[model samples]
Target: EPVEVVVERALAAQAVGIDGVIASGQEAGPIRAATGAGFSIVCPGIRPGGPVGDDQKRTVGVAQAFADGADAIVVGRPIRLASDPQAAARAIQAEIAQALAAR
Candidate 1:
């Protein structure tokens, strides 16, 4: 769904005492715009620039997610499917550190 629709639903949920949601990195911008700091958005399907399977959509990188306004990010495939899972995890953590520092 578009970020606008996501935000609308989030707002509706917030009206009923909800404050957190899982969203795409692409929706981060509109989420921040509409809900500001109060709503928590956890971005999933984060891809770190590699060949991807067709199962995931609306994916974004760690840096882009943070830059656009995702409060948190979930990284899975990049690490799970990597030749060196440990290294991939380290790299992703470093990327997360850098993005957080930039913030």
Candidate 2:
């Protein structure tokens, strides 16, 4: 979706008393600004330097998602399809920690 439309919808959702939104990381920043700091934004389609294929088009790294004002992120394929799920999860956790520390 176009970012302007996504932000518009997020603003509208907030206006009607919606508490949170699921947006792409790229759109989270504008949504945050429109909805204020306390509003929750859960971003999906997170990719950490892996092949994205064609399933998820609007994806970002964990660090970028947090940097773009994502309150939470939903990660799928990377951990799900990893040869070592535990290690994949740990790597993502480490990325999250580094991002938070940078903030």
Candidate 3:
């Protein structure tokens, strides 16, 4: 869900009995919080540094977004734009592992 569509679609999904809602970038945590407990929020446009020439304006690092209560963070360009894509992904994974371990 984009910021413009979150409230309506989130409520719609909830009305339809969907298990969860995936809100992109900025809206994930707030949408999840707004939707109340037990609803999952999958956030896209997640990067360890920042946006990487991608269309996603709203972005945050893995640890920060995870700390903010996103159920999951989606990464695309961060790994795709890396010189060593696998290593970049592994690094991100390691960060996630650390974050999760701390929680």
Candidate 4:
């Protein structure tokens, strides 16, 4: 099936009580629009910078993901490679705080 069609189906499934929907950065907004407001959208492969070491073609950061209506954003390597993992997490938390404040 096409990606859009898959998103629609995923949204429909959530409407009928599926646990949640996994959306890519590009798919997050569209899936959210397709589903009801209450549907949970979980986005993975979120990298802040434009070209990380990984092979993920589509990616967005925590703030952007939240801004795009994602219920949650996942960040992997950025945190792992940080000299201070706690500080990295704190920065992400700060980003979330700013996003929440903006909203």
How far does residue 47 in candidate 4 sit from its true spot (Å)? Answer: 2.0
**Which scores higher on TM-score, 1 or 2?**
2
Tens digit of per-residue lDDT, candidate 4, span 7-38: 87886787688967777767777777777578
Quote the lDDT for 48 in model 3. 80
- Work out how many backbone clashes candidate 2 has: 0
Q: Pick the candidate with the highest lDDT.
A: 2
lDDT of each: 0.84, 0.86, 0.76, 0.75
Candidate 3 per-residue lDDT, tens place, 1-103, comes to 3564776788788888987876665676667666876777788889886555556677877776676667788888888999999999999999889867765
lDDT of 1 by residue, 27-56 (tens): 888877887788888999898752256578
Candidate 4 weakest ten by summed lDDT: 46-55
**TM per prediction:** 0.89, 0.91, 0.78, 0.81
lDDT for predicted candidate 4 compared with the true structure: 0.75
Clashing pairs in 2: none
Candidate 4, residue 18: lDDT: 92
By summed lDDT, which 10 consecutive residues of candidate 1 come out lowest?
48-57
Better of 1 and 3 by lDDT: 1
